[model samples]
Target: MNVIETAIAGLLILEPTAYGDDRGFFLESWNRRRFADFGLDLEFVQDNHSRSAAGVLRGLHFQDPNPQGKLVRVVNGRAWDVAVDIRAGSATFGKWVGVELSATNKRMFWVPDGFAHGFLALEDDTDFLYKCTSYFEPANEHSLQWNDPILGIDWPLDGLEPQLSGRDRVGMPFAAIATVA
Candidate 1:
């Protein structure tokens, strides 16, 4: 696997080597020992899978008291994934990084605890998966407005409008989250 570091600390892009034959391809998505070799000795407590239609957006979400470190990727179709640095007192606070994750690229994104994570489905029926280091606590979860002007995330929306959930539509602004984060 090739680990690519992002501008913000602790955020990474992992590309695993795939071996293929006439039938198909195989690649190890996660192996405890192998990940440890790269200084990622993490313990995941939960796994999640979500499917989104084109233009669907989820998150800019994170837990405060129980921040989760996530290893996320797209298993089918494509998505424009983003991670924002919301960790208080960090050098990159309010900064963000975005990447295109797709089944074809077979790349994984690592979003450490203390950051806000979100993605926009770029294709129909996008299957997004993630392994979380901490179990989710609904009450502790908060969503930073996906289109918050302060964060200024450049989502690849083109001519499409993002479909958001009620929670997301009413998310707190980045400035407001500063106090809580």
Candidate 2:
């Protein structure tokens, strides 16, 4: 596996070395020792999967009390995955990085704790999967407005309109949230 660092601190992109033959392909998606050697020592406790249609946008969500470090990948389709730094004292606070995750590439993104995660489906039916370091706590969940002007995330609209959920559409702007350390 090849681990590449992104502009934001603590964020990483992993490319697996796939072995393929005429019938199918094989790749170790997650190996504790290998990941640890690569500097990611996350003890992922929960795995989650979701499917969305094209134009569907989910998130910019995080849990305040127990932030989740996520290892995300697309298994069936394509999406524009994004992660925003939200650590109070970090130099890259409010900055974001995005990457195109598709089944063909099989790339995985490591979003460490202290960041908000989201994705926009780019294909008819997209299946997204992720491993989280912490279990979800609804009472402590928060969402940042995906289109907040201050953060200025350059979403690839490309003449297409995004379909947002009620919760996502009503998310509060970052300035309104009382982020803790």
Clashes of each: 0, 0
Q: Sum up the clashes in candidate 1.
A: 0
Question: In candidate 2, which residue ranges exceed 4 Å CA deviation?
Answer: 178-181
lDDT of 1: 0.95
- Report the lDDT of model 2 for residue 48: 98
Best by TM-score: 1
Q: Per-residue lDDT tens digits of candidate 1, residues 80-146?
A: 9999999888999999999999999999999999899999999999999999999999999999899
Residues 56-175, candidate 2: write the lDDT tens digits.
999999888989999999999999999999888889988999999999999999999999999999997899999999999999898889999988887887988799988899988888
Instruction: Specify the highest-lDDT model's number.
Output: 1
lDDT of 1 at 133: 98
Model 2 residue 104 CA deviation in Å = 0.4
- Model 1 clashing residue pairs (backbone): none
RMSD list, candidates in order: 0.8, 1.3
Query: Which residue ranges in model 1 land beyond 4 Å of their true spot?
Result: none
